[model samples]
Target: MSFGLEVMVRSALSHIGDLIAVSLGISLSLNNLLTFYADRPRAILAAHKKFMLARVAELSLLAAFALLYQQYDSLYINTIIDTAAAQFDAGVPLHWQAQVAACLIALAALIKCAQLPFHGWLIQVVESPTPVSSLLHAGVINLGGYLLLLFTPVVAQSSIAIWLLLLVAGLSTLASALIMTTRISVKVRLAWSTCAQMGLMLLEFALGLYELVLLHLLAHSFYKAYSFLNSGNAVNDAIRLRLSSAAKTSFQQAQTSNTVVPNAQTWLMAFSISLAVVIAIRSLFGFDGAFSAWWLFALALTVLIVQWRTCEHSPSIIYTIIMGGFLCVIYAALKQAMHYVLPSYSTLTVQAFSLADIWAMILFSLLFVLSAFLHYQVRWRAVRRLSIALFAGLYLDEWLTRLVLKFWPVTLPARTKQQHHAKSTHQPSLKP
Candidate 1:
């Protein structure tokens, strides 16, 4: 329904349906919040409160777009485009007010999508019922990307808006992906992973890969839905798999060796293999397009292929190569199909990787390498401290919870003294 509304808004050049669609999107988010309220899990009440506040911010920013519509005296989004085009023709930049409106809209998208700083709410939304979590993660929250895609003409005109989306979304992707690895609980990890994936989706929109965004949006929706529905069975399945593997290994000598951590030399080899594969694909598939989306996809595939070779229980080289080739071919084919099937409502323009973008990618690469090193190497004091911080989500959410509570006190359900006493008395002894 949201997608249908978005399609209508995009197709209707003169209707005020954009505002209506955005309003409906917000309503859906509010519904999710209301569902959370009904369940009201005591453990996550504070998190739910923060989530509500973030939604309020999101709602406000989305509502603010109405001001722009009124200012132009036309309910049509074409007004924004025609005005900007006129300004561009006249060798004039967009008005400051227009830029401000664009930034506000982008910020709203960031909040809706649960990017960093505002990200605490999203990671903590695990308190919601699994169905709500599935709906929020899979369906509702994705409207942010749609919003950006819908308003690309106005939003992309402002350099401030562009940089804001890029930095915030990119950093959020990096931070959330890193933080997700340190989490232990299955649901919490899934929540963090959602945050990371949202960040990545937003980042892709900022890069003007709308087709890729659509593909990701569809794929993630199905995957997240299945994951959340089957979440309860995850532990059971893991245990069963472990037992089965143990049974199979009992008759043979067990290999209980420590995992071999890939050293610098191994990393170099992997890098070389990845590069060669990328070059081979480019040469064979005539993917020598602009140094943009294809290159990134190739690099990602290269990394996966390397991991397939090095990771525990690694697949055979022949199988890995075949899988990599299949993935590359399928992705390229799908991207090409989407190019024809999905029409763009606005001109897609993202400046090729700026220094900031490059630096961010480099930083993420370094963090990933260090994390892998720490995971396998002897746990030094520094590694331990880093791991602790990551495990605690860098205390980022905790701090946000504190600040939010300071301003908006959440009234948690009061526990009886007897309940507290019972909890205290029931603390399990560690003695074996």
Candidate 2:
């Protein structure tokens, strides 16, 4: 696994890197299946089944690349990028072959990144050892986004391929992010978070924001690794947080006759402040795509405002404003650093406005509004139903699981009396 990853990092622009990376992914999947087969045979088998499906898609991607090599007489990624970029600059559409290859690549990436129906494997793998789960989420799962970034030039030239990634990743991002909140287990929540983060990263790639993708990849890796390694402390942390929240709630009830919910004007003020802060930071950094960046900033700021409103004794407004500005500055600086370090094609400037960008902005706004509604309107009947559906992942994974098991059944070992007793006594229950 180590050797495969090393080769992947060192030779990412070559065919060998792609081969080794996919091989490593297969090896890891098999490793997870085998390592815990004795303890959780059913889950391991299901995970392996999904991995095999992903393998087929990845093999198709490789075959597509081979066809591209035949047409272009080159397998080097840099050469393909140059060819695609030149064609794009000259207003020539990508060859049909390149378009097919890009589409196949997108399909493989979506499956590998655990989007939607394929995400059950990622959640199941939490049954493995903590270290294994950490490595998988932090290091291996991100290879899908890496694959997309490596072929950015080709993907950029194919509008069909780009939109395929955009639509799938966008839905997965929104669904997974919302679903994660409905989970109770720390590791399960983290697994869903990885799904969401991967979706968002792929969405950024589809939007031609390669620099942002790189930064996101690195930051998520570290964060996930740390979260997994420290997950043992999560129970204690949750207890402390609940206690503090209870105390805060009691104090707020005592101090105020009514809850001080933020009105439309307060939301407007927060949005305006967030927009100004983002614009100022982007302007200072000489960044493009200010409008897209502002949407993200506004979403974050509004979430912050909602949290503060719930707390009632959170930081003062001036401190909140200062922290918001500081965060924007930090984000801009990191993005600028990414632009400086990445390759020219990966850092190519995007248009100020496009259909995809506009759609993504609208999606962000919708998510922001949804989050606020869910947090504030918990008593609403529709919200309760929506929360239940989200918690169940809308049964998307269940249909896939049933289909896989029906076609490719696995034999289970006979259950011992002790195992049966334990199962009867402590059957697992879902938590909201």
Candidate 3:
């Protein structure tokens, strides 16, 4: 917040941009060099050498950053804010400790721009299949979010930071969506969309209230992950490209039509339902304030499912049982992890083996066994049913269990028995 420090921080941020630009330049230069000399059979030796050198460049930078943080005790580059965060706020002499935050912010920004070692072989990626490109450059990568999250304290405090993130997310989204229209390659469009979505999430984290940020991130990540995993769009595009390439005499280009009706009713219904759900959830949860609701998550999931193009039909009873069993596996993993990390939470036992805990455990142990038996549980109907059930459970935890229990306490059979015994003994004494 101090004048000089702010200037220095901005300088550091600019440095990050500069680093990204430099990395981009180097990457493109390597591309051209590879194109010209990389193709020669004899260049295979040189290719290996160049690859090794690029790897070295990446590793060296990473190590230097690590060493700088380690040897310099005054340098505080740790994730958790130390004096540097404060000093970064103060214009104090770049205490060896404080300069690191700026450096880290810079580092994270640059690392984000490059998309890192995964896409290090620039020529190879530029020549990759569409699906691969989408997954690599656009869809699957999550480092940007991680980086932003890592430095949220620094970034979130400033309006410019929020605006920058919004610009990135918004512009990327628009560019990708627009480009998708012109792109013959579906996967490429998907990649662009992913980048845009990621930017949106980063923007939301920067601009929105802090509470909404993580949930937004969670939802966006999963939705994007789902789309990236089963992207038939790219495959479809590949087929179209192949068809176009095939002999013209043997086949005719398929006629396209704009007859597909824009389903306004469905969109309206979905939006209404989603909004209703958020309001209902908040109300049911008995949120501290009235009318405070958020449904970014549900919408994201719904979008992903809709895009996956699924249909529903009744699942066999056996299949449902099998799916329940899968939930058991998930529950088991969750419990094990929770137990390992949070031993004190075991106090969450539901009142000395009440129907709640008993049923929960039985359900946990049984559901997955059943699901395993009914392992062919791929139908959307089954998935929908399971999802609805899960949502019901979440509602119970978030709303009913908390709010309802506070007002209406449960009466255990043991308590009832004890009361009866006490009354019986008093009656005998009174008669005497």
Question: How do the candidates rank by lDDT, highest first?
Answer: 2, 1, 3
lDDT per prediction? Answer: 0.66, 0.75, 0.39
Query: How many residue-pair clashes does candidate 3 contain?
Result: 15
| lDDT (Cα, tens digit) per residue for candidate 1, span 231-310 | 98988987786679675574243356556556677566556655566566656765322234555565566556666667
Please provide the root mean square deviation of candidate 3 (C-alpha atoms, Å): 28.4
Candidate that beats the other on lDDT, 1 or 3, i.e. the better one: 1
- Compute the lDDT for candidate 3: 0.39
Candidate 3: where is the Cα deviation over 4 Å? 1-73, 83-125, 129-135, 138-141, 208-267, 282-432
Ranking by TM-score: 2, 1, 3
Give the TM-score comparing model 1 with the true structure, all chains together.
0.82
Per-residue CA lDDT of model 3 for 1-432, tens digit only, reads 233323423444334334344544554455344434333432333233334434444443454345445534423333232343454456434443224433444334433433212122322333333344434443224545644543444444344445454444444433333333333444444544554455445544543333333444455566655665566666776577667746342345334322222244643444454445544544554332111113333343233323322223534535533443443344333323322221121111123234322332343234323332232332457654654453232232234223433654433223244446768787432110
Clashing pairs in 1: none
> Per-residue lDDT of 1-432 in model 2, one digit per residue for the tens?
124333543565466356647655665566654456454665566566665666666686777687678757887766666677777777777778888988888888898789987888788777777887888889878878887876777776778888898899888988898888789999999999999999889888877777788899999999999999999898888678667978678767768864556777777777777787877777788766525545777679767765664574777778778988988888877887776656655333455567888877877777777777677777789989989999888889888877877977766456656667767889642210
Model 3, TM vs. native:
0.39
All models, RMSD in angstroms = 4.6, 4.4, 28.4
